[model samples]
Target: MNDSENNLKRFGENLARIKKAKKMSYRKIAANCDLEHSDIKRYVDGKINPTLLSLLDLAKGLGIHPKELLDY
Candidate 1:
């Protein structure tokens, strides 16, 4: 895979790890972030790269800093 694809995969893994560590569910996170459940799943599944805004929303929903999500 390309660098971008690899990055997305890593980001997805990090996102999933962090979310799980927080004891949060995908559906709950999606609802809190005002994002579609499918979209959140795509990111966590490494099927799509999330936009900056989506990342911001996710960070907010997770009660984390945006940089935390990008630390991967």
Candidate 2:
């Protein structure tokens, strides 16, 4: 995979890890943000990319810093 693809996959992995660590379900996180559970799922599956605003929303939903999502 290319660098961008690698980064996206790694980001998805990091998101999944943090979500699991916090014991939060996709619905739960989605509810706290402006996203849907399906969208979160796609993100975790590395099937799509989220914008910068979406990143902030995810971080808020997960009760974490936005940088944590990019830690990968």
Candidate 3:
């Protein structure tokens, strides 16, 4: 994988960990973030790289800092 792909994978893992820790499901979190459920799954699967704005929305939906997702 390329650098960008590796970063996305890391972010995905971190996001999944945090979500699980908070007892949140992909569907619930996606709804809270006003995103498609598949989008959340794709992100968590590291099959898609979210834009900065999408990341911000996800963090806000999770009541977390965006850096928390990126810092993984």
Q: TM-score order of candidates, best first?
A: 2, 1, 3
Worst 10 residues of 3 by lDDT: 28-37
All candidates: TM-score: 0.94, 0.96, 0.91
Task: Enumerate residue pairs that collide in model 1.
Answer: none
| Model 1: how far residue 68 lies from native, Å | 0.5
- The local distance difference test score of model 2 is 0.94
TM-score of 2: 0.96
Task: Count the clashes in each prediction.
Answer: 0, 0, 0
**Which stretches in model 1 have alpha-carbon errors above 4 Å?**
none
- Residues 2-66 of candidate 3 have per-residue lDDT tens digits of 99899889888998999999999888888788788789889989999898889998997888988
lDDT string for model 1 (1-72, tens) is 999999999999999999889999888888788788788889988998888999999998888999999998
Cα RMSD (angstroms) for every candidate in the order listed = 0.8, 0.6, 1.0
For residue 16, model 3's alpha carbon misses the true position, in angstroms, by: 0.7
lDDT of each: 0.90, 0.94, 0.87
Measured by TM-score, the strongest candidate is 2
Candidate 2 per-residue lDDT, tens place, 1-72, comes to 998888889999999999999999999999999999999999998889989999999999999999999998
